[model samples]
Target: MSKKIREKKSTLFSLLFIAAVILLTLWSLSRAEDPDKLIKDIQNASPVFLVLAVLCVLAFICLQGVVIWLQCRSLKLQESLWRCVLVAFHGYFYCSITPMQSGGPPIQIYDLKKEGIHISVGTLIILMETFLFKVVLVILSLGMLLFGHRLMRRYIWPGLFFFILGTILTCGIVVLIYLSMFHSGLLRRLILWLFRKLEKHHLVRSKKGRVEKLISAMDKYRAAAGYFRNQRKLAVLLLAVTMLQRLAYFSTTYFIYRSFGLYGVSYWTIVLLQAAISICADMLPIPGGVGITEALFQVFFRDIFGTMTIPGLCLSRGITFYAQLLFCGIFSIAARVAFRVDKSRLGFFQTSFIVPEDAP
Candidate 1:
């Protein structure tokens, strides 16, 4: 299919998914004795907590920029921090609309190329950032499984089996991606062997070009691995920053819980639940994990907090996902406008900063 058709389809699906999520959230609330009263209760909850929840969401957005900035600096890219922030918002806008966030990296790479970074470097930066992000996610989910298995069995749907399966799959994918960049000898042999088999079966016209591309990517990965290894301190700092980024993002749930004054579950337990939700969401094909998040929230919190699950879902999603979606969507548009204006003034040749040809 054409790109335009795919985009239109994605837009249509995103709209429908978002509507479904809204309806599901409403339905959850409607189960209450009085839905309006429950909303009123949420509104009447601690104002401080509400504000903190918003701040935490905002912090989450900013921390993504920090992760990119640090990784870019490690690669010797001199892009401005504001550019990183714009990239984060712009990526979020696309990611929120596309299924499984498949649209995000391309947009980010396009934006970075416009800023004068080479496409190759931009891709590496994104890959490194994504690797660290996935690492943090896998670690958090494993922590939940190890320390909160009882809660998982009791609350999460599909119980321990589902959680373990999802977490293992996610971690395995991440580990393979990481290993591909640094230790790809086995992967390269396997890929080449598969391509050779296809050629022998007359399935492919030519294997030479595709094999070259695979080798090129393997080289890029090796370079990235070596560069990062030489910058061990920066690598450690990037990991820590990524962890903080997730904590700030997930802490939105904690603040939202406090906003409703339901303290039955400890903060740690809530974090674990949020981690599980994230793991499940990754497994889902839905855009923004809309329906899946609502379903998981209901399943995970209902028995624990009774009717408070309704408000919890409402406030948690309202403050975190929906709020971020709306705000970042607008910010992305504004950034594009500003970038266009700046580009017009600077001319194409002057837009990008020169990097050393030999540098990774």
Candidate 2:
């Protein structure tokens, strides 16, 4: 499909999801006793704490931008800081709208290519970024599961199902990434074998051509992985940076909690819970994990949030999820305007074989 048509579809899908979220939230609020009072309670929340909570969310975005900048510097790519920020926002825009946040990478790579980075390098950068983020999230999830199993059991029931599923999903991705990075040849062989079967059964065309292209792409990706492996210190530093990025997101709950005069709960405890909530929410195939996320918030924090539970959900989801959606929408336009992104350069979605790269 053409880029224009694809963009229209994306816009429509995003609007639909936004509408669903708004309607769901309203429906939820309508069921609450004295919905106006709940709004009033949220409105009465301290502006200072609310602002801090937003800043934390922005920090999370900024840290992602920093990751791109650091990766560019390491690769000697000539992308500017502002462009990196824009790319981060662009990724978030697509991620928030799509199921399981799956629409992020292609547009992100396209944006990087617009900034004059080679597509191959951009792909590797994003792959590493995603890998590191998931690794940290999984580690945090496991740590929380191991240490807080007893406390978590109180909220187990349905949330536990999602939690387990999310962990399994994350672990699956981690394994695939490991294979791609360290055992690319084996990955390439397995993929080729699968493709051959599909072709044999008339499931795909261009069998030989596609297989050759796939092998080429895997080689490029493996080479990129090797580059990072050789830069061991830089790789380690990026891992630590990514961990902080995750923490910044987790800390959003802490600020929101404090905003409501809800205190005495250990921040780390909240962070752990936030990690679990995130793990479960991320696993769901919902746009922004909208309903699931809110439900998880209520289930996990009911004891601490008590009467303020609804308001707390409103604030937390507002700042971290919906607010970022709005931010990405506005900033993405601004970035495109500032960068003068060419219409033709913005390609529509397609899965292609990665070819050999030239210098950026």
Say which candidate scores most in lDDT. Answer: 2
Q: Could you report the Cα RMSD, in angstroms, for every candidate shown?
A: 5.0, 4.8
Q: For model 1, what is the alpha-carbon lDDT of residue 101?
A: 68
Query: What are the per-model numbers of colliding residue pairs?
Result: 0, 0
**How many clashes would you count in candidate 2?**
0
272: Cα error in model 2, Å: 1.4
For model 2, residues 178-273, the per-residue Cα lDDT tens digits are 777767678768888998899888888854477776766676676666677788888888899889988888888888888888788888878878
Computed on alpha carbons, the lDDT of every model, listed in order, comes to 0.73, 0.79
CA displacement after TM-score superposition, residue 200 of candidate 1 (Å)? 12
- Model 2 off-target regions past 4 Å? 1-3, 154-158, 190-218, 338-360
